[model samples]
Target: MIQVTPSIAIDESELEESFVRASGPGGQHVNKVSSAVQLKFDIRRSPSLPNDVAVRLMKLAGSRLTQDGVIVIVAQAQRSQKRNREEARERLLELIRAAAVRPQTRRPTKPTKASKERRLVSKDKRASIKAGRSKPGAD
Candidate 1:
C-alpha cells in the first residue's frame, strides 16, 4: 500500500507497471534490456482518491492522462528496471501529493503608493535615456 497522506493509503494493485526498452546511454544493454518503467493508474476507477483530488490530478497530469482517465508516467532515468520502477512510483506519488492540496487563492492587490511612484520614476528614467539616445537635431 502506498500512503499519500496520513489517512489516505492506496493499494499496490491499483498501479500497473510495464517495462520497455529505454533509449540513451547503456549502449548494448539498451538494445537487450527493457529498463524503463511505465506506470499507469486509473484515476477514474480508483476508489482510493477523493473526487476533488482526482479532478485536480487529471488537470495536473495534462497530456499524461488518457481519454479513459488513466495517468501514464514513464521513468527511464535509471539503468536498472527496479530503480526505474521505484522512480516511476515516486514520481506518481509526488504528482498526486501536489494535486491533493488545494492552492491558496490569490487576493487582488493594488500597488502601494510608494511602489507606484517608484515604477513611474523608473519609467521616466527609461524614457529620458531613450530620449537622450535620439539622433542629433532629431529630438
Candidate 2:
C-alpha cells in the first residue's frame, strides 16, 4: 500500500506498470532493455479515494488522464527499469497528495473606492492628453 496522505492509502494492486525501451544514455543496452515505465492508475474507479479527491485528481491529471479516467504517467528519466518504476510511483503519489488538499474558496470583492477614483483619474488624464494633441479648432 502506498500512502498518499494521512487519510489516503492506495493498495499496491491499484497501480499497473508496463515497461518499454527508453531512448537515452544507455547506448547499445538501451536498445535491448526496457527501461521506461508507464504507470497507470484508475482514479475514477479507485475505492481508496474520496469523491472530492477523485474529482480534483481528474482535474489535476488534465491531459494525463485518458478517456476511461485512467491516469497514465511515463517515467524514462532513469536508465534502470526499477528506478523508472519508482519514479512513476512517486509521481503518482505526489499527484494524489496534491489533490487531497481542498482549494480555498475565492471571496469576491468590489474595487476599493480609492482604486476606482485612481482609475477614473488616469482615464481623465489620458483623455485630456489626447484632447490636447488635437488641432485647436478641429472639433
Q: Which candidate has the top score in TM-score?
A: 2
Output candidate 1 Cα RMSD: 3.8
List per-prediction Cα lDDT, in the order shown.
0.93, 0.95
Question: 67-133, model 2: which lDDT tens digit per residue?
Answer: 9999999999899999999999999999999999999999999999999999999999999999999
Q: Give the C-alpha miss distance for residue 118 in model 2, angstroms.
A: 1.5
Please estimate how well model 1 matches the true structure, expressed as its whole-model Cα lDDT: 0.93
Clashing pairs in 1: none
RMSD of each candidate? 3.8, 1.6
